[model samples]
Target: MIHHAGLIAAFMDGGWRGALIQGPSGAGKSDLALRCLDSGFALVADDRVELWTSGGRLYGRAPETLAGRIEVRGIDVLPAPALAWARVSLCVRAGTPERIPEPAFTDDFGLRLPLLTLALLESSAPAKLSRALRHLGERR
Candidate 1:
């Protein structure tokens, strides 16, 4: 079940679950995902993600094509631990801009997941993402 277009995964809550970031190519998804992982977020999947909707709810997974793989520019693809496929809460779609500024928005499949878009150039994007995740959890 191919998710859609472009996406990356991040494991949070002690690997209990994860969030998926859906965006287009060259949107700096991997770079942002990597930064988030470096700041303690685990990589569930990068590149291709497989999604499924059941019981009027949405679920997602990493396709076998790009499971356990994280790409780094000018470097090899880093392997990640096995993920038990979790539900997605938030989807972040950021671009390569100057600064993160404030949290942005991302919505898909009729579900509005307030995505926190940040410019990849900003070194603090991951930190902001982490904070956004925490805020999301608290709000939910």
Candidate 2:
């Protein structure tokens, strides 16, 4: 397993795919993830995610002790709907998002996933992520 310093959340439309949210401490990784979960995505891991590659695809899972738990800032750690694992399709970096971000990708266990950069505190962050995933799906 590959240890990661970020949050992993999954969304299922016809199938499941995850987004690896990475950034510095207090960069709103968990906040954006919670927004995604609120928008119907499932939690794979929070704060720390364990990644692995299988059949050329990268997948993410929560460490045993952290499964089904998410720490909301200023609130106690809360139990949330979670997935044991998910195939990751994207990596969202929590930073300054461009009006049209230059194409980017992130590597996990030798597998590459599309990267979308965004400012997590923006009110439209969740909607923007959803849109990006949908656009990615159309290209697949």
Candidate 3:
């Protein structure tokens, strides 16, 4: 079976396989996830995603505990849109200082996936997330 690391934020509506947003705590991972959701992406799991391997493909599901709860800072915990099960296709690590240089690709268990490192900027995160996801889809 596919073994997953810690928490993962996956998208469900854009494609069959989703992107796993990973990073150290307080790196805005959840914030990015929220932005992605606002940009038409479904939340698979906010803080936990179950990973499994089948037929050489890796899939993920939302953990029951944090399934619908998405933290919105001052807004209190909110329920995200219903999630869709999906296979994980990409893993993005959060950058310190809120931003990182635009990355090209990153390695995951020896496999390479395109990178869209977060550069901490006050710009529209949702729009940026949408653009990045669209780019990712176009690449495949």
Highest TM-score against the true fold, candidate: 2
Candidates ranked by lDDT: 2, 1, 3
- Report the candidate with higher TM-score, 1 versus 2: 2
Clashing pairs in 2: none
Worst 10 residues of 1 by lDDT: 4-13
How much does each candidate deviate from the true structure in C-alpha RMSD?
A: 3.5, 1.8, 4.2
Query: How many pairs in model 3 have backbone atoms within 3 A of each other, for residues 3 or more apart or on separate chains, i.e. clashes?
Result: 5
Model 3 lDDT tens row, 20-102: 76666666767777766655677777666677666655567776776667778668878766555666666656554235455
Query: Candidates ranked by TM-score, best first?
Result: 2, 1, 3
For model 2 the local lDDT of residue 124 reads 90
Q: All candidates' lDDT scores?
A: 0.63, 0.78, 0.59
Minimum summed lDDT over a 10-residue window in model 2 is located at: 3-12
**Clashes per prediction?**
0, 0, 5
| Model 3: lDDT of residue 96 | 42
| Clash-forming residue pairs, model 3 | 2-52, 2-53, 98-120, 99-119, 99-120
Candidate 1 whole-model C-alpha lDDT, 0 to 1 = 0.63
Q: Give candidate 1 regions above 4 Å deviation.
A: 4-17, 55-57, 96-107
Better by TM-score, candidate 3 or 2: 2
Off by over 4 Å in 3: 1-17, 96-103
